[model samples]
Target: MTITRGRFGHYKLLKNTKRLSPHVPDIHVYSESVLTSLLNNLQPLFIRPLLGPELIRIIKSGETYNLVVNDNEPIVTDRKSIVPCLIKQLHPKKTYIIQVNPTISYTPCRTFYTLQRKREGANWKTVHKTVQDTECTPRYMNFLIHWKLNRFLLAVAGKLGDAFVGCHTMVLEIGYAEGAFFLYDTILHERNSKWSQYQSFIRSRTIRPFMPHTDLCTKSTLKAFLRNYGKAIIKPAVGQQGKGIVKITIMPSGDFEVQKRNNLSTYKTFDALFQSIHSLHLSREDYIIQYYIALGIVDGCPFDVRVITQFDEEYGWIATGKLVKVAAPGYFITNRAQKLLAVEEVLSVPDSHIEQVCINGSIALSAQLNNLSIIGFDIGVEEGGKVWVIEANHVPSIAMFHNFGNNEMHTKITQFIGKRRRSLSENRKEEG
Candidate 1:
């Protein structure tokens, strides 16, 4: 079984299907003439790379066109100049695709939902209809019905499933435009979904407020962010165990200080600073740049809280365990820690507040995606007692509890796991 990856591959899969072809917007390989033609025909269109997370949207406004890259502000350009502008901004060798941007009802914001679907025997089911992209709690099926897209989206899912071999699950991104719903994108693999963690959480109302400012790292973005915040952290887009993490700070003497694990390097120029980080991180692959939260200190070391939430068949989502990971001496990341303390022992805020936030946030997250029974949230607290969510782990390790020697919390987590397993067993028995 062969599975195709990348946006262009999926586009081709749908384009060849007579029934699904019309639903997909007209997409073409990037060229000056092709782009110019698209601009003339479509008022608003999108420019996406063949592979990667970069997106460029061009919208017509009055006599000029507005180019919006990712979440940044729009840059105005005339029709004649827009093509050149993109060429200068985008990589020279990488291929890009231009497509007609659908006229969705709502403008792009911090919120969007994923339509989770899974193949059951010979059929595919839309398990999660609305991942709560907006404030109103609309049933996913009902919303699709209102837009008259219930059948269309389902059909798209089935077709894509058949096209992607050995793929039994998918997350569809649906959009409404011109009184019809269209497939905006598809998460065909679990790894792709995991890479979308930052994006998925930022859309949640419960989690967005607590999320620190985060963006993909680049030399320009890194310099601008550091100039504004004076400190920032760079992390691999897909990484674990706190490895490959880098922190940059502007010292009192105005030099740029970079820290990885416990070692520190200082540079006098932004160029030199960027080089250190680029060689250490950026040149290899994508990394996330986030505003550094001055974490609350515990025993002269910064620490962050870890809250584990699990779903109970009878009770919904619950915060089963909470602990603080204090960074070892001379380190900022709490991944490798010297001490593990109870939340109450370290945080000034009431224990209830932390639990409530974790539970509520987890519930909001569960609504966004499917097949979520457990989640571990990394919570950060500043010196001023404010809480921020650093990251949400989909498959949170129970080893932390065992390592901390909190048998009570460890038992609670295992009990929830056991209950979920038993529930699945009974369901399968009934099916059998």
Candidate 2:
């Protein structure tokens, strides 16, 4: 793709590809007067109810009225009587508009609109929102179908790109929450890469094999993971709000215990722990068991840092935001459901290292993800200065940051989008 800048905007021009030829219709020009004459000639009796009173008056008064046609003919016999005719003439390969809601509608081929509903009293109002050509329709059924089909086609195209262009990239998520993997895969495919890029990168770094819940039957792999890290956390692969997480730790005296929400606790031995994991009966496909990283504590509470990476028009791979999440008292997770703390309050170590670790982690993650334009990295530093990655989330929650009254994250995101828009406008100019 060749990106060019001009007065209009940034536009991409395909190189070395045959330009599509325009196909002219046999009847190319239908004069407005001719169309009006045709409508005028229609019988009033046949058209009256069809056009509706408001539309009929407009047509009689020589005002513009919309028309709807099928097979080159108006569908309603009484054209004048029809309500303001929103005439959409269909051609062999012409685009059409389908209104899904008051606020949002979509053109047949170009865009999809996603609309949100706001409830006021007993009525609902729709809010039209446009997302980068990807979300153009408000119909859930159509949206899902489009997404699946697009993903499949993108995957095939990505394979072709890999073979020809060899432009491969990795995807990393720091917080693997429910929607995290979905967004990661979405971005990967959108950028013409395979979801395997994410999985492969993660698996290659860990010494022991990490198994999704589905592979839990493999006792050897499970034991290896537990022994290597001395503890393991079993969590739902597609969970949010820090729900359904069990931290399994083996004490120095050889006793084992499982920690969960609401202070629920279970004591177990090695055999018992294995049984407990099996008894949960969670779909192995939807869960993951990983070695737990004992992140350093602040005031005896564990905390982690979240780093957001975004592409900069001037400086690439800039760290957009950083914040510390402190776990609630007697809890292992630092989600909102847990407690949140400031960076200074969380890290027991020197303050200088906090920024340094965050900067280093952000850079490393950005490179690992093949210089992905956007990502959120969660980093944990142990008491002994061992930094471990908990996970990588592509669309980490910015709600918490916003709630905390921090505008830095919002500003960075806005700047990133603005730069892209300006780049797009520039490219359009060169194309013209």
Output the number of the lDDT-best candidate: 1
The C-alpha local distance difference test score for the whole of candidate 1 amounts to: 0.73
Q: Worst ten-residue run, lDDT, model 2?
A: 20-29
lDDT for 232 in candidate 2 is 75
Question: Candidate 2 residues 1-432, lDDT tens each?
Answer: 332221011101111112201110011122334445544432121111111011111122234342322112224334453432434222324222121111112222222111111111111111111222222222343555555434433332333233323223212111111211111111112222212222333334341122122122223434656677677777654455567777877778777767785365555576566656555523222244665777777777788877666666587556666677877788888764355555565556564544444444445444434435566657677788665556556556666666554676667766786786788789899999
Off by over 4 Å in 1: 6-195
Computed on alpha carbons, the lDDT of every model, listed in order, comes to 0.73, 0.42
How close is each model in CA RMSD to the real structure?
10.4, 20.2
Error of 1 at 70 (Å): 21
Candidate 1: worst-modelled 10 consecutive residues by lDDT: 109-118
**Candidate 2 residue-pair clash tally:** 41
Report the number of backbone clashes for model 1: 0
Model 2 scores a C-alpha lDDT of 0.42
TM-score per candidate, chains pooled:
0.61, 0.46
